[model samples]
Target: MTIFTANPHLLSTLAPFICFIVTVICLLTSIKIMRRYRHKQVFIILICGLGTAAIPQLLNAYAASSLQAVPESLYIISTIAGTISFIIINFVFMKMYAIGIRIRIAPILLLSLGAAIAIAASFLLAPYEIGGTKALGFPVLDFYMFILIITMLVVTRHIEMPAAYFISLCVMFSYQIALMLHQYVFEHSQPWLGALVMALPVLYYFLLFYLLLEWIMERLLTTYQSAILDGLTGLYVRRHFQKKLAEMIARKPAAVIFCDIDNFKSLNDTKGHHAADQALQQVASILRDEVAPHGIAGRYGGEELLGAIEIDKVKPQTIAERIRARVEQETIVTVSVGFCTTKESAELASLVKLADEAMYYSKSTGKNKVTSYRSIPAAYKNKA
Candidate 1:
């Protein structure tokens, strides 16, 4: 506290300088993300907001550092620019949320633009000189901020929001309150209060930066998931499954279970693709759930699912049977399950082939049953 008061001019100059630097960093980062991610329009608005906000900091820094008195008109311009920047930044937040929830934002945009224009015009048209130790438009800015906080609260109350978003809103509310107090109550009397007012924007911008990073990480994760997982069944795709199976076998003896839905083509032809897809999804879900703890489950192809389990952890035959029973009991269609353990063949291709042969045996003999590659009769297994 003493340090803040000891060098009020230095603290004031440093605070705005730091804020300007932070704003520029955030602006550059936003532009980079926008270009890299190709979110041109949203980032453009954000850049504009940051750019507007930076102006006041620049002006404040110059005013604090300069020996001569800065013109009142310049201070007026800074205040108006800062206010408009706040409006734009809040509008960007609302617009992002609206886009996410599929709500129309054109009305919000128009209203925000109108408010910004009105604030600017009102401040400019009013005849006010910088009276001794008095600032201009404190009441107008305070009223404007009050309205914004209330509107934002209403928006947040109705919609579900992330913790970061809620925290950012809280920061914004605190900033507005601090700003009002500093302008009216303290009137630059307390150095600590001035420091706090300047620092809050840095915190708010930092939170915004964190939010942007979170968004980028989420997008990357989504892209990776889509690449490795089946879009319909939520199981691993064939290529990724094979890669996982290879890794699993390299470590320990494993089992590969192949499951094909019984009469899937007939189901598709008779009940339509929708019914067929539902059956596939149901069967895949059962396979995925049952095998999840022990190992991996994936969609090998249409109506064909595969599961690989480390035999030391769980019995593949038991899992295969459970999958068959679940499909029969829970779904409109049943599955023929066949599994081959690594004891039979260590090669990946051979294990898959043996599992396929066993699945065919179950299919040809009866539908809705499980078959072990080791249990198939020699005569049936040898049949070309």
Candidate 2:
């Protein structure tokens, strides 16, 4: 204890306080994220791991050189427990990525318990005297540490995550390895050296907690986006069209183009569902290629697509004609387009309905032609 206080190493005395703050912060942050994200259980396991490592480090720090005569056996047992906890936590983290969240609690607890037992038994019962069997001294410690590093790297590579987490993990492991090698070969056992060791994992916990927050945020954004997109065509769905229409009405200068694949049902019946799906996808691709840059093209319904674009000086019919021409040139399948501009109707839904009517007119007059409702007779428009 006197040696630790007198030691010049800044890492020694500072380690416990640093560990305490980091562990508490990580615990609070993880709990907060779990509540906000509602992706619990896995995060709970992670927090437990951080707790296991942090609590023992604190205990070891206070008891290491005190007159209470902390048994070496206690240190060994605590280290074993902490190591087992870490292994279980990492395994749980790994499981989440592979299989997704667990719905059943029993199987999850069963697996976690089994993993913890196996890891603990390996340290407590093994005969080889793996990595040295004391605090960060076991050869198995190195093996497990190496495995954890590799596992973390592998997990990071596959999962979408922030750069901060991987960088922190790299620093944490690098220091651990350095400390282990220093202890094993140099015979340097200064208690202060343990401060840096404890701090490293705490840093890892903080970074991981932040990464989890980011992960949850990203998932929320993705869900929001998917809600508005058509699953089949990867284009805007009808829901998105209504939103775009509202914007167009506010701006008062946009084109609405309605499109329908010619004889799509017949084609589907002749070619079978798979080919029809491929044809639909191909048509969607062409539509996206032609209109997506200038406007938003979305699958409105089966065999129907809608697009809207900002129109400055040019007529909406011109925009619609261009899209129709591109679809004809790009794919064997042709689409009939009907367009109306905001000058004709300010209401978004009315404009889209007008466009749909015009498209139907094109189908009636002839297939694969672009038409507008401006010139068509009211009776013909009514029929359309």
Candidate 3:
């Protein structure tokens, strides 16, 4: 066989092999991701795209490298289809991963559609006349690839994901741009230069997929963390704090304080819920400012708050009084506090009860007072 007869098919064969390897890697990675992270949306899209990718790669290989007869139309269709499919998969993957984060979906759709159109136009508008490159057979695939990169970058900026995904995408797009530049610079004398340059995008894509998966996992973890934090006060909520206290009990020392508003019902009835809410915010801020240095403060419920302080020697009454005084000075709305501590107590509910008793004791004496279980007068409790 002449060198010419053997050569034209070589590019086709190698392209399929490269694509197959990428497909298999993606398939295995998808399975691992589903098993490990259980990201059903991402896994399905990737798997479907990877599968679609395999058929084109195989067809391209057979048409180029093997003696088997295949239609040129099939090769062109596969190549275009593969590119479009991959771009769509990536766009959807990003949107799925950025659940809470806001993104502009309309642009992403337009960009991906533009890529599909560019690929279709390349084949449909090819020059019918002989030796005509400019009239209709102009190369438009590069433009599509460039636009795809730009759209992906724009989409990612709006979504909150790990830095690695962005970095990987940057690398992928940069490599594509460099490849395009390399082709433009050395189009003749080395046609294989184009293929080599193009190889970079494929290679970078493999890296990009893994980085995207990691970004999804990181985003999930961050979302979970946010769910446990109180939005208004920047503190762990009652449920989260209760869980933490349970864990702390199995380990070491802790203290608990429960606070309630003095005549808070009357305050809400008089000032409206909005003003009451503002007062609640003020109380939270004061507690955070005064007690958070030594502990954590959270709004337990309406007009009631709680604090957990870790102390080796400081008494619970001291922590309670510090918070009470600061809260009184911070707001026109006054609060009563009750506190209890035990280095060995594991049940937070027990401490909460003790603190509640002390708080009621303060209410009985007067509004805007801090009382501790240790300081409660026995006769004062009997009246209530």
Clash count per candidate: 0, 7, 1
1-384 in candidate 2: lDDT tens per residue?
A: 011122335455455555556666766766776676566777777667667666555654564334243455555555555555555454544544444534344644654465445456656855332135333345445456556666667756766434775676686567657556545554345454555554666566566556556666767788987998887788888887788778766875887888898988988888888877877788787777766656678888899988887777556677777767776886657888888777788887788888888898888788799888686788886665
Superposed model 2: Cα runs more than 4 Å off: 1-44, 57-74, 99-140, 147-169, 188-199, 313-315, 377-379, 382-384
lDDT of 1: 0.76
lDDT rank, highest first?
1, 2, 3
TM-scores for all candidates?
0.86, 0.74, 0.68
The CA lDDT at 285 in model 2 is: 76
lDDT of model 1 at residue 71?
A: 65
* Span of 10 residues, lowest total lDDT, candidate 3: 129-138
Which prediction has more favorable TM-score, 1 or 2? Answer: 1
Model 1 misplaced stretches (Cα beyond 4 Å): 1-14, 61-70, 95-134, 190-192
At residue 136, give the lDDT of candidate 2.
35
Predicted model with the maximum lDDT: 1
